[model samples]
Target: MSRIKQVFKGNSQAIFNIKEIAKICKIHRNTARRYLEILTLKGFLYETQKGTNRIFRLKTRDLRRDSI
Candidate 1:
């Protein structure tokens, strides 16, 4: 999960879909999606729908406030 967070922190301006995040973190797509969902729920990330894909981006304000 920290690995996933690192990916977002490293590319704060970038938006990512599950597949890209999964590949970057070397985890399964399902795992990436699950982690992303948790982050969204925790207000660390913003989730948006781009057609069939669910895209995620770091919530910059929350990123500065939260450790994770």
Candidate 2:
């Protein structure tokens, strides 16, 4: 219904990796990555890079959705 909500639900997998985001969002890798980067920059999400993989989590612990 809302863009932020969509980003959290249809986009939560991105919280794991951009590859998952692309698959879930049904978009190109670059596009999905852009979404992750944008969200991280906006402070809605934050990323933790471990080796070659990145883990994304929400900045505000207060916000939790069924998808997350």
Candidate 3:
């Protein structure tokens, strides 16, 4: 599985920084940032930027089912 997929699927309450992803996924932090940007664009994640850091969270699952 892609690193992004693994992270998002493994933990429901996972909110992670690019730094954490880099460390855990063994990818460059810039690559982590790109994963986040793509997930955010796809509506599977949300980004909260504070200063120079970013915190990402999964969008609520209920929201996904409600659209059906």
For every candidate structure, what is the RMSD over all alpha carbons to the true structure, in angstroms? Answer: 1.7, 4.9, 3.9
- Candidate 1: list runs displaced more than 4 Å: 61-66
Candidate 2 lDDT over residue span 34-57, tens digit each = 777777776777887755676676
Candidate 3: Cα lDDT at 68: 15
Q: Provide the overall lDDT of each model, using Cα atoms, as 2-decimal numbers.
A: 0.85, 0.62, 0.75
Cα lDDT tens digits for candidate 1, 22-62: 99999999999889989898878887775669898887644
Q: How many residue pairs clash in each candidate?
A: 0, 0, 0
Question: Model 2: clashing residue pairs?
Answer: none
Whole-model lDDT for model 2 versus the true structure? 0.62
A best-first ranking of the candidates according to their lDDT comes to 1, 3, 2
lDDT of 3 by residue, 1-68 (tens): 27766776677687888899778888898998897788788787888666588888887664334321
Residue 59 deviation, candidate 1, in Å? 1.1
Highest lDDT against the true fold, candidate: 1
Q: Looking at candidate 3, what is the lDDT of residue 52?
A: 87
What is candidate 3's local distance difference test score?
Answer: 0.75
Superposed model 3: Cα runs more than 4 Å off = 62-68
lDDT-wise, the better of 1 and 2 is: 1
